[model samples]
Structures are given as C-alpha cells and as structure tokens.
Target: MTTMTPPVTPPVTALNALGFDRPAADTRVVVAMSGGVDSSVVAAMLAREGFDVIGVTLQLYDHGAALGRKGACCAGRDIHDARAVAARMGFPHYVLDYESRFRESVIDDFADQYLAGATPVPCVRCNQRVKFRDLLATARELGADCLATGHYVRRIIGARGPELHQAADPARDQSYFLFATTPEQLGYLRFPLGGVATKAETRAMAAGFGLDVADKPDSQDICFVPQGGYAAVIEKLRPGAAEPGEIVHLDGRVLGAHRGVIHYTVGQRRGLNLGGGDPLHVLRLEPESRRVIVGPRAALGVARLRVAEVNWLGDGAFADAPPGGWRAQARVRSTRPPAPARVLPEGADTA
Candidate 1:
C-alpha cells in the first residue's frame, strides 16, 4: 500500500490559483519606456501585475537639431507621450538626459565605423552601451532588481544557461539588434511581449489601457537621425568623415569618383556611377587608399566571417576549443536566421 503523490501543477496555473500572485509583485523593475506602443504596454502590464514599475526614457539626442526632423523616436513629442502614459498608469517616470553619452557611444561610433568602411550597426551599440550598461546601472542605483524593455525577443532560461530566441512574432523579431547583449545582462532583463503578441494586439492592449501612445506611429528611422538619412548626420558630426574618394575596378583601374567611403557598404548596388558594361557592386571598401572597390556580385559570398566582441550564451561552447574551430550558429546580422559557422577564438579583442 503505497501512497501516490498528486501531479504537480504548472507554475502559471499555480500562480493564477493563488489569486494572480505576480512573480515580481514586491520587486522593483525599471521599465525603459521609449514612448512607443510596445514599451508603454510593458509598463502598464508590469504595473497591473502588482510590481513596482518605474519608467525611464533616455533623451538620446535632439532629432530636430541633429537631423532637422521631428515626429520620431526620442523626440520632444515622444518624450511627452511617454510621460503622459506613465502618469496615466500611475507610475513614477523620469527622462534621463543621455545626449552626450549617446553621441559618444552611438552616433560618433557609427560615423567612425562608416568612415572606416565597415558597415556599422548603431542599434546594437545602443542596446549594449546605452540601454543595458547605462540604463541598467541606473536601475541598480535606484534599487530596482531588473530592467525591462519592449524588445520583441524571448529569453529562455534553460538548464544549462540562458539563451536568446526569436520572438513568437517572427515579423517583429529583434534578436539581431540584440546580439551584443551579454548573458549576465539577460539575467536582469525582461521582454514582456516576447510571446506571440502581434503589433495589432499590442496596440489594442495600449488602447484598452488608455495609453497615450496607443495611436502613435511606429518609428521607422534611426532614433537619432529622424530625417531617415545617415550621410548628412555624419557629415555634420565629423566634417571630414566624408571626404571624396576614388572608385576603382577590381583590376586597380580608376572607374570614377565617390562622395566618400562613408557612403557605401557591403552588398550596396546603387549610386555607383561606374558606367561599365556589367552591373557593378560594392565588393569592398579600402579605407587605406580611400578607394571604393567595385566588381561583380559573386565576390561577396564567403563561407566564414569574423565577428568581433563575440558573446556566447551557453556554457563553455568553446572552452577547450582550438583557435579557428568549434561550430555554432553565427548570426551575422539581426533579423536573419543564425547560420552554421565554425567560431574560432581570434583574440581577446577580436572574438
């Protein structure tokens, strides 16, 4: 006569049965509300779940002064809307002036990388330096346990370690822009809209909660460059960053001239004024010679890529691995699926 144990209930069900006991009820969380629908909903949801939510919006840059544009993310109107939403949700909100930091970390780096002829991803840098580093530190100083954002990606806590996965909504997956996020940071970060919530659903939730950003249009341009162009912004920031350079063919013959090395990137086909018989593509950018290399499209395909500042998720994926070894899914850019690659530890700085 053995006494059989009852089946264990799931945590979600147990939590609900216990009268919606919020996992973070007494925990203080700093929500990075970007005056967008998704972030606004995140704040509201956390508040509704009985957690102490504090909203902080980083005033990254002046859209009007920088790009002579308005009505984009991080502008005056967006800040007002975010503050209004925080008020409506009955939470404390603060706008942190991060203009200088943003310029140094994101804008300056972007311009410098472009001038150096490497395709720069500013959003990744922003997430790494601004949001996670600066904002996360602020949250800690404010006695908050964690930082939350409106990223459309999922962080799954696995037996081995935490892993970042694509969002339930495939269309809005932001994993690419978040590749720079470290594993330690993931432990302190939360994405409330990770699971299968479409943009329409998020907007509806905002409307239901009476958020001021319910009808706000999604920001399509870079938050700093509201006018939807980067060339002008770079020119203004670093006057000589866009010096005119020569466009050359694969055979080292000068084809024509280009505005600057900053104007081109890998896989770019347009604006190359080389009137040759065959269509030309930007094969490579030689910053040393200040020359734009144009050639046929077949030169772009490479089986290997070197990603600097590599951050691994799992435990010891390459602990005993040799240099130029160890296979893993390498995501070159965000939004694209991670492709199979042999990741080798190049060096401390060039991983």
Candidate 2:
C-alpha cells in the first residue's frame, strides 16, 4: 500500500502550422481541390509538410455537359486535373457526386432569385451551401481534423475564436464571397493560400512541387454557368423565365419593350436601344409586374437600404446591437472598397 502507484505523466501538446496540437503526420487534413493551380498548390504544400492530406473534389453538375467547358471548377476536365495532382503529390483523392445537392441548393435558388427580380451570386451560394457545409461535413465523416481550401481569405485566431480576415493580397482577396462562413465552420477551416502575395507565387509553389496544374488557367465565372450566359442557364432551368415585358421610364412613360426582366440588372445603362436620348440606367426590376423600370443615373442613388440574412462574425450575439445601430464598414460590391456605415439590427437575421 505504501508503494502504491507511479504518478501518471501527461503528454505535451504543441501547436502545429495548422494550430492543431499534434505532429503534421498525426493531423489529418481534407483539402477541397477545385482542380486549379490555387488548390493544387495547397494540397502539395501540405503533403510536403508530411501531413496526412486527402483531396476531395465535388462534381456539382453534369460532367457530360461540362466535358469541354473551360474556366470552370468541378467540371470533367477539372476533376481529371485534380486527380492528377493528387497522384503526383502521393495523397488519396476522391470525387463526390453532388449534382442533386447543387441543383437544390445553388442552381434552383439562382433561377428562382432571377425570377424574383433579384441578382444572385451563385458562387457565394455554392461556397456557403456546398463546399463549406456539405464537403466540410464529409471531411469530418472521414475523420479529418480540419478542412483546407485555396480560398484567398485568412482565418486569424482571435481571443474570441477564429476570425475571418481579408487575404494579404488585396488583388486576389476573396473575403467578400466568403462572408457567409459561420463561426463553427471557421473553427474547422484552414486557408493555406491566404497569405500568398500573388497568383504567380501560387503557381511557383505548384511548379516547385512538380505538380502539372502549375500552368493551368484559373477558374472564371460561375462553375455551373457555361459561356458566361446567365440568361440561357436560367431559361433552361426554368422555362419561359425570359418573358417579354415593357421597359418603362421613371415618369410613367413606356420607353421600350425588353425581352425579359432577367436580361437587365439594376444599374444597367447599355443595350436599352431607346434610340438617342438621355442615358438611362436600370433603377430596379419589378418581376411581378413584368416591368423593367429605368431612369436617369441619379435615381439609382440611395442613402440607406435594408439588408437581409445578416451573418454576424463580430463579438457577442447579433441582438446586442444598440438601438442607434453599430458602426461598421459596408461593402456593396466585392470589387468596391468598404465604405463607412451604421448597421441597425432589424431582427436576428435582418439588418
């Protein structure tokens, strides 16, 4: 009894590059490869660090239709390229068929939003619904410690938790499109290319790793949209979405007839074909009334507008917003710099 038992010693835990308390080999990472130079470099870099890397590519649409399509991710050609990179890097690769999920989540929403006279960013929807949500879940099912991606956005560790930040390279930053990433998803996500200065640097890394995708062109436009034809895709998904309607001026004047409300977006000025008059911009679209409302550029300006589905990444609960509203930077467009603004909470999800 006096010589009872030896004291147990706890193993020391150290933070690796991914902030995981384990060796690189012990940390299993699932990289979402889009078959581009950006993703290829990420997979290769992790493999070089001796991590257990598994590359997964989602076939979001019909590969048969995407066989010859260029400048799109998750296509037939892209899947092939992703597989090649995985083979070269000596990591396991997989292709998951997510066509049905994509249609329900992204494609259908895209067409519906257009029908409702609102322009939808399918890329953001795809990221929010498919890649970060579904694919991240798949990674967990495979026993992965975290999911890594080639997105040009940083996940900085803050006192509160992981905070999403703009990439070091502003020119290639994709932070705007990734605004929907929730706190929980941010915890399990990693962006290896976030700190890279330029696309050329990523390409260089790919070349250094001897990956064949080093020179592959970057994915352009929406992955599912072919030939940059948004209207055609919408029409195919929802027949007769392009119903012809009257293009009316602001002052209750019918200027011309437009093919459909889907063809013109807000703030559009060209292709009106009104035949010589003051330039008019698309003030808004009234799909229910089948009206393409147009007016002078001055009519497009607005001091304030309500935003819905607000994803708060800031401190504390969204309901904590003061009655006067909170000071914040608002970005209306991804290409535009964020402007000073005050955000008043309308509800838990609206602002």
Regions more than 4 Å wrong, model 1: 1-24, 66-71, 322-324, 348-351
Error of 2 at 106 (Å): 0.4
Q: Residue by residue across 1-351, what tens digits does model 2's lDDT show?
A: 377788899978878989988899999999999899888899999999999999999988886766677768988888899999999889999999998999999999999999999989888999899999999999999999999999999999998999999999999999999999999999999999999999899988999999888888877778777777899999998999999999999999999899999998899989888888789999999999899999999999888999998999988788898778888888888888998898888799898
Compared with the true structure, all predictions reach lDDT values of 0.82, 0.91
Q: In TM-score terms, which candidate is top?
A: 2
In model 2, what is the error at residue 177, expressed in angstroms? 0.9
| Local accuracy of candidate 1 as per-residue lDDT tens digits, 125-217 | 999999999999999999987898999999887886677988999889998889878888988888878885688999999999988688878
**Model 2 residue-pair collision total:** 0
